[model samples]
Target: MTTALRTDRYELTMLEAALRSGRAGRDCVFEVFGRRLPGGRRYGVLAGTGRVLDAITAFRFGQAELDWLADERVVDDATLAYLADYRFTGQVEGYREGEVYMPGSPLLTVRGTFAEAVLLETVVLSVLNYDSAVATAAARMVSAAEGHPIAEMGSRRTGEHAAVAAARAAYIAGFSATSNLEAGRTWGIPTMGTAAHAFTLLHDSEEEAFRAQVAALGVGTTLLVDTYDVRQGVETAVRVAGPQLGGVRLDSGDLPTLVRETRAQLDALGATGTRITVTSDLDEHAIAALRGTPVDAFGVGTSVVTGAGAPASGFVYKLVARRDGTGADGGAWKPVAKNSVGKRSVGGAKRAERLLRDGVAVAERVVVDDDGDGIPERDAADAARAEGLTARPLTATLMRDGEPDPQWLGPEGVRAARAHCAAAVGELPAAALRLSPGDPALPLVTA
Candidate 1:
């Protein structure tokens, strides 16, 4: 396997600042602000809170980070002063994880001031945006699978931290388990593994290798049936493990054809009870192609982790609504915006309304303000959401009143994503799952 170094350039710098002074109760406000995709996206999933939490923990501001920050002095003296005394003290509010969201929806809000909130932006977005994108893609794939088990094995394709977060995201999107050990350790996800070609190649013969593995791992161990000869591998696997062999996995060649022939062979050999799994160059489109095949599970690597072939959505963080030093509603309340084309953002706190027709999500719209009032209802309201489903996903209370609450989410927090993804199954527009360019876009209206 190819290998390379993974990097987190700014984390140490910021954490050092947090570590240096390590102050407890500083007020700050952190907000998540991003807009629609190029083609207006009406609905979004609150995808990556679990992964975001990971980075926050990593933001420990230890001695190493402090040394780097001092060595470079990335910020001025005043900025450094803020960093040394960093600790968020405020409250936060946002749409619950897995809730359907929309453009201008505050995915999250951090309520600590200056140092506390500002430093967290880079790290939090790094985890949330990346993992959320992967989770969104995985949700679509899981929907297509119709309850088939999904195995994630994309660690080789991404950075180390990204690999871990991808596993969490995929889980949140309803995947059954991951091949990432780190994810298993950090997030409590079920970890699974299948023999690679290397294992087979290490043995004197494929038969000998299969025997050794079955002996060590039991008959339930899945046999990789595509090393040298697909049919030969399957036959050898049967000879060694008999009719009760747990499963035969195909990693190469045409998947549908392989499953058909492989199933026929297994059945003829009285191994009908054995399951079939497929992997290799697969994506959402590929998985969709195997609708009624005998394939029992899918091992998705690159595409699912990287976002169903959509590498990354251009999501950004902006100060859409801030309490700029002004005096309007008892304080300064001027809306500020960075008016650039294609990247313009609304100024002011925002909310998202997930409109439902019947009991399913139809689209999402945005409402901006600074108040406790909920979102306004539209002309047609689904019975399930008549009470209104607005998301003010950002607030400023991760670290509050100079001390952090022990209520921080653990690594496995993405379970909620998985549950929500399951809940949204029947609600997703089928056409939206297509890989083609021309389908109805997720509608996004800004007010």
Candidate 2:
């Protein structure tokens, strides 16, 4: 499907204005970064770069879209012609998906003509902000779980499409599986779901429901045991599925107490091997509170898909550098920035690397190139060596000349991102894993 209309009107209007003013073809560099970590987050996990690439690829103005825009008089004929041929034949560089980021990290950089690049601001920010928020929240939950697997069951708590995206993002940030089937099919994420409360209520009794589920899904299926009475349901489940029942889900009540009681009951009933999974409106805090309990897994919904408490990762895309003159290839780059009160921006194309000591991340080093030429690999390495620390280059070439790097695209890309997230989070200082509100785990050092 065409994603051209998934943008704000101002993008096209600005494109039209720039085209008429003869500045649309000017070379431009746009960078995406966050001013501050939302909700005092220690770090932000980068997600949705693959989705952004897909969106950019599908950002075509088909006949239907052009017809609607013309009918609404959204732009003039000249702009419509431009839209008909709108392909982002540009270079895109950014931090790899699932990487941890701090303020001023320069998460994404788009280098293209003014017209092509300006039209991408809204779509780029929309994907990065929402996906990164879910990923950051999921990472926190993963840390709080302290090794228990988390299932993304928030499909019902968010928009249908957003639910799929959230599932993908959560998995990239260490979630074990998702209840969203589309996410599984699209991104190769593991899919998991047993049954909801309604399924239990559909039968003549809880015993009937347990029997039906076990018969269909085997004794290994997780039975919802909190449907009516927690203890009675467990007793009935054990009677039906026997001691070999795979697991029981507690979706309502005091989880810590209930989990302990359920474990004891299962042990007494000779179902000692049965695991306990909790799903009662759990957030990171709630999961942390159950640290020493017998809970085996977590099914997160509202708190995860909605980004815990911060739904958007306050990221902004700004034109940091452009050609000094209107000519596309005739002028040196001139840095540009906004100094509007508290909304100030840094004005240059940048290179970022993580400073590491003994495998622990110490700081984020951002080098601004005012001349618009990116930092060379040897120079970056030399600077890091001079600082007496190992440097890990954070940015990578995501796209070149309009073609996305397949390594960061498809199901394999998701798997790669998931592994990268694990490594990235592991490299942070031990204090970074704490759930308390505090400053970012690493300070930003700009050069």
Candidate 3:
């Protein structure tokens, strides 16, 4: 489907004004960055780059969309004509997907004509903000799990399309699987789900339900065992599925005490191998609190999908630089910025690299390039050498002249992102993984 209409009206209005003012074709550079990490988050995970690329590719103003816009009188005929033939033949570079970001880090950069690039602000922020929020939260949850697996099961708690996106983001942040089938089909994330309490309530009794589930899904499937009584449910599940039952889910209860008791009961019943999966509005903090418990895995719903209280990543897309003149060939690039109190943005097109010492990330270096010439890795390395540090380039070419790099587009991209997230988070200091409120793990340095 065309993603053109997934934008704000003001974008088109600005385009119309720029077109009339003869400045629409001026070269421009827009950037995406966050002023601060949300909720005192130590770092933010970058997700949805693939989705943004796909959206940009599909940003077409088809006949239907044009008709709707005309009917609503959203723009003049000239603007509609421009939209009909609109194509973003732009250059996009940004931090690689799964990379951790800090305040003032340039997460994305778009270089194109003013008309072509200005229209992308809404869709870009829409995908990046939400997906990054979920990913950052999921990364924390993964850290809190202490190596235990987490499954995304919040499909019922969010918008239909957002559910799939959340699942993909969660997977990119190291989630083991998802309950959303569409996410599995679209992103190739592993799909996992057993039965809810309704399945147990559907049968005449919990035993019949357990038997039905076992008969259908086999003894290896997890059974929800807290429908009626936690103890009785566990006994019935073990008795019905035998000692080979794969796992039991405790959806409600005091998780720490219940998990311990459940583990002991399973051991006494000779179901010592039965695992205990816990679910019930679990966030990273709750998962961390259960570190000493016998919980085997986590099924995160509301918290992970909703970003555990910080639903938006607070990222903003702004025109950081533009041609110095209104001519088509124009003069040198001029940096632009908003200096509003508490919402100031640094000007100039920027490149970023991580400074590492002894394999641990110490700071993020942002290089402002007023000439619009990007920094090469060799130069970054040379600069880092002067300071007795190693520089790791964080930005990559996401798209060139509107065509996205294939490596960062499909299921393979998600897998690569998961691996990258693991390594990137591993490079941070141990304090970065803490759940307490504190400063960002790495400081930001501007050049």
lDDT of 1 by residue, 1-447 (tens): 100001244533554464456432233234575565423332345566644543444444445554565677664455455445444444445555565554556677665443445556666676567766787677667766877998999999999878987888788778889999989988889999968999999999999999999999999889998999999999999999999999988988888898999999999999989999888968777888999998999999998778766556445655444444322342344455678987776665555555555555566565566432223344323432455542322222333353433444665345655665667555656665555445233566655
Error of 3 at 62 (Å): 1.1
Range of the 10 consecutive residues with the lowest summed lDDT in candidate 1: 1-10
Model number with the top lDDT: 3
Question: What ranges in model 1 sit over 4 Å off?
Answer: 1-30, 38-44, 57-64, 324-330, 370-408, 438-441
Clashing pairs in 2: none
Tens-place lDDT digits, model 2, residues 228-325: 99999999999999999999999999889999999999999999999999998899999999999988999999999999999999999999999867
Estimate the overall C-alpha local distance difference test score of candidate 2: 0.93
Displacement of the residue 289 alpha carbon in candidate 2, Å? 0.3
lDDT of each: 0.66, 0.93, 0.94
Query: What residue pairs clash in candidate 3, if any at all?
Result: none
